[model samples]
Target: MKKIIVVAGLLLTMGFHASAEGYQVNLQSTKQAGMAHVGAALKLGAESMHFNPAGLSFMKENISLSAGASAVFTDLEYSKDGYKHNSDNPIGTPFYLYAGFKIYDNLAAGVSVNTPYGSSIDWGVNWAGSRLVQDITLKSFSIQPTISYRPFEKLSLGAGLMFMYGNFSLSRVLIPAGDLESLRPFAAAVPSLGQTLDNFKDIDAASATLSGDAGVKVGFNIGAMYDITDKITVGVSYRSKVKMRVPEGHAEMNYANETELKQMIATVNPLLIAYKKNPIVIPPLDKGTFSAELPLPSNLNVAVSYQATDRLLLSGEVQFVGWSAYKALNVQFSQEVLNGYSINAPKNYENTRIYRLGGQFAATERLDLRLGAYLDESPVPGEFLNPETPSMNKMGLSTGLSFRPLERLSVDLAFTYVTGFGRDGSYPYVSNDQVKAFGGHYDVKALNPSFGISYAF
Candidate 1:
């Protein structure tokens, strides 16, 4: 039971990493996303609240509103030892809404609601790696109220209070049907147990489902934007790390061969009693609960925008992700059978960087065109990679356009394509008190289409 409980925690911890690396959603603004999600140095009115709040104070409108959503279609494949598996992931929808108003000559205020981190990966119920992770879905959002102040005509500063909430549900195999062969030796020593175990040769494996809701956590986003010249601007921003805690979570167990399992336990008790060994006990699923803590890493961005001509603008940015803060995860279960057991798993993630470049051209009075590209690095080491979150370095290409149907209203559309550099990695852990490992070649790719509308007056 102890070994079973520990493997459960091991799988849960691996599932949490799905929110980082290539899985972080970056579809806040359709107009910005057209440019590979680079906008820290641009004056984007209400949309600036997400890229860089400092740009809000430079808005030309008294009121601004922007809302948009994207559909993420992802594909993942894994191959190992002549076995191939593909993820049947559902389409992920990430959206954003921002509203800002000019409070005074040099002051601006706004609020933003967005889904910034999420992922859905399903490798089916009986994949080759089902023991590690069969499926996982993570959802999270943040609401921020921001304030921007332009103390000087050429300089602006801003800050926002971030309230974040998240939740996840995952399922994994606890004991595979094939692993039951280990009991063959014990069964041979006890004829009654052997007879009972023979009836379970074709039974389904044991599995578990874990679900949890994290409490609201607080963080901050701060930024500065400066006009270096009439045609050039520079900006920097920092988003603080948020620590999310699950006070109480639920865990449910499913045993396909319950009857046969109980019979074997009953039959083997006498042999254990003669050897003075403790009797085996199974915990009740209805009363099982757990607690865990996870972290959303910090972000640092530096960007610059250049206006080359009256109708053309170019922007570039560098983003540093502080994934190193995610050093470990601790999970505790409230089950009498566990004997106060806890699992502390180490996740030695490394910091990573993203480089972005984008260009926007005003083709006509009512139309604008944009194109962008970015490179995102993977934070996970090769040896630590797992199927739950098979991460690798990726490249993104994007294009978008904005059409003004009315003087104060604009319709935006953007498309982004992501391709990962295929990778091969492995993860090792203890299963049934024995050291084991899982490894394979992985490939990932995705397409995102975004639609949005912005109004200002």
Candidate 2:
């Protein structure tokens, strides 16, 4: 049998999903989450900083503040030939805070601190596909200071500077086979198999596991809204791409499985020694740090709102993700020998469009009810849905309510259930540079619950 050895290059996919639009936590405001994030054109005040900062110009209060968080629960199931393996709950909590104040009759300023982009995926300690990934954690936050101006009676424009920070970490088993018995045949096939196998036979006793992180990134956002009629408004917004660089990262190893490595080396030593060739020399791992770069994508959104009646409001929005920019993963390690090596993964992610429809009703003088639904198209081409991120297209149902116990204070709550579309992606060797993931069928689902409070003065 031909020995197929994997590369020891640095991982590039680490930064691929951090700021993904599909992965961005929408819990910054329960009000928006409940309405399927529909308020771009009609929204006003602090929370508008996320969907469209320009909406802040319509605030009815002199000052407003809101805080909230979302609890995300997700599940992914993998199946091969009818058998299945389930992923652990990749639970993530994203927090949001926003403050807005009227600077003048037609101008406003606001600040928002939130976790807009992030994810956590854990496949656990041992699995049928340990090489794929064991765990993934991406923590990101953005502090945006924004200003909105209503230069015209029915129009508003806004811009903000996004001070973004995202930290990425990943862990996976590098080499699954640690036993000498399993290494023998793979070793015996080396001379015919080439350097990959010859190098595998000389695998470092300590290099069986891998892990690392990407330090930080920065970006920005711009938006505007226009009133077409007394009861109609249109909105547009753009968020710039974040550029990230990890100058140095650490990868640790456990030597508990060194026994098999030693035996493999000891058994191969005699033949080479007796044959007059130099005995096998096990290479030294002797390094811990590496460096890499991964850039997230950008996005544009257009939304509209209509006042259908005195007690009802209607909304629809379309968001365009620039995923086509994400074409490949590139990483450069720090070690001298590894300096020439890189782990590159191809993610031919295509641009995606998300559609949302929602409605809001004033149930009473102090109460409002909101309901909505949306379809999110996955940018990840099935061929690219690897163990690290099995991203898929989904449809979600959401409902929420806001109750004003006092004239100045209101509490908001929302619930969202997203159902994912599953598929079976088979890996067929396409190109020399194209690396494929373990072939399998995947099923996924998510539940999001959010709570928040807003106060105006």
Candidate 3:
């Protein structure tokens, strides 16, 4: 049928842009009251373009906007001793939008649209680890354009440019038997009639698919504030590290009953080519085109702040993430019968450090209150836990509230919580007589919630 509709439109254009390893879902946005205070204001405003665009040079005088949403919950488990499985995923819905503006007098600008990363898992295909993975969904979105500058009075600088979008889906199944392919024998082998066969061969595919490519990222932020008198005031900021690239697409491989396995490999390729003329490793029904490559790693932030009165405020922060440049997964096949099948996916991912503390209280003149805490560390390790991406080590909690009622109008709310402490890995399967099956060990847990709102003109 037109070659199965042009191979299903090239597997939907190879799903668009591939670059997924697993465990990513931060959602970005909801620091209402700056998570209690620690955000310290990288210059403060336009949501500081996601935490620091020199805080948009402390934008003032008309122009500001914000919106938010978040919800994520996950709990996955796999066991042995008679086999048992569990999965619960649903609570994902991240939404956001931001805007800020100010021109001349020191310049300032902003823009944002978020959903940092995403995830979803579904398991149970008859258990027994179902080959290791049953279902997985991923998403990433970002849009940032910012600028800030303040020549004097205490320094301030900012810049940004980010545009990203991603999506993915997965599924699996493969089986082979028949006495392991009749113990490979065509003539020599007669030890009283060697025997062992059960007859079996089934290879199903499609766990996830979708890809699109794009790249060009950059970030910078620097801030300083000092007034060690008149009641003391000090602040510092530095944020940089953003490099992303995702290019390559087009993939389609749908073969199951593909015309009765292409007429049983054209009747067993001329009877195995006259009983072994060497030119038949079980071939037939071969189609092509496949590609994938993704790398977007970099992060660093440091902060410290103190107001201590006039409504109270205090903050602290430190964050760094490099993720060992994500190990491997370079697969490019256009027929060579699957040349050099690469899929290492091991970088032992590390380079992680996160700590934050906050507090803010106004309680009058219009009301305001906030509180925060965080500690996250886990660059996936535990034998490279896999199920697409199952990471661990996390703890966070935050609360916020703000209101002005009028005077340009203002209202904001925030909430956050994350927890995950479970680990174990190993999942690799490849069979078609090319034998290779190893799938066992798994456990995971996660949760998140956030909200936001702001307006001034």
Q: List the lowest-lDDT window of 10 residues for candidate 3.
A: 1-10
Model 2 spans > 4 angstroms off: 1-6, 9-22, 177-181, 184-216, 255-286, 427-437
What global local distance difference test value does model 3 have?
0.53
- The better candidate by lDDT, 1 or 2, is 1
What is the TM-score of candidate 1?
0.92
For each candidate, what TM-score against the reference?
A: 0.92, 0.86, 0.33
Number of colliding residue pairs in model 1: 0
Q: What is candidate 3's TM-score against the reference?
A: 0.33
Least accurate stretch of 10 residues (summed lDDT) in model 1?
Answer: 1-10
Task: Return the TM-score for candidate 2, rounded to 2 decimals.
Answer: 0.86
Ranking by TM-score: 1, 2, 3
Error of 3 at 228 (Å): 24
lDDT of 2 by residue, 1-457 (tens): 1122334532534433321244555566789888887767766589888889889888888998999988888887889977788878556889899999998989999999998778887776546555556677777788999999999989899988888777776665445433123334434534532333344443322333344445555577889999999899999988888866667766665442466545655665565455544544432323646665555567788999999998899899988877787777766566776664556667677889889898899999899999999888888786667656677777889999999999889999998888778766754332112455568887778888989999999
lDDT of the candidates, in the order given = 0.83, 0.71, 0.53
Better of 2 and 3 by lDDT: 2
Candidate 1 ranges beyond 4 A from true positions: 1-7, 10-12, 17-23, 184-204, 264-286
Compute the lDDT for candidate 1. Answer: 0.83
Per-residue C-alpha lDDT of model 1 across residues 186-232, encoded as one tens digit per residue:
66577676655556555445678788999999999999999999999
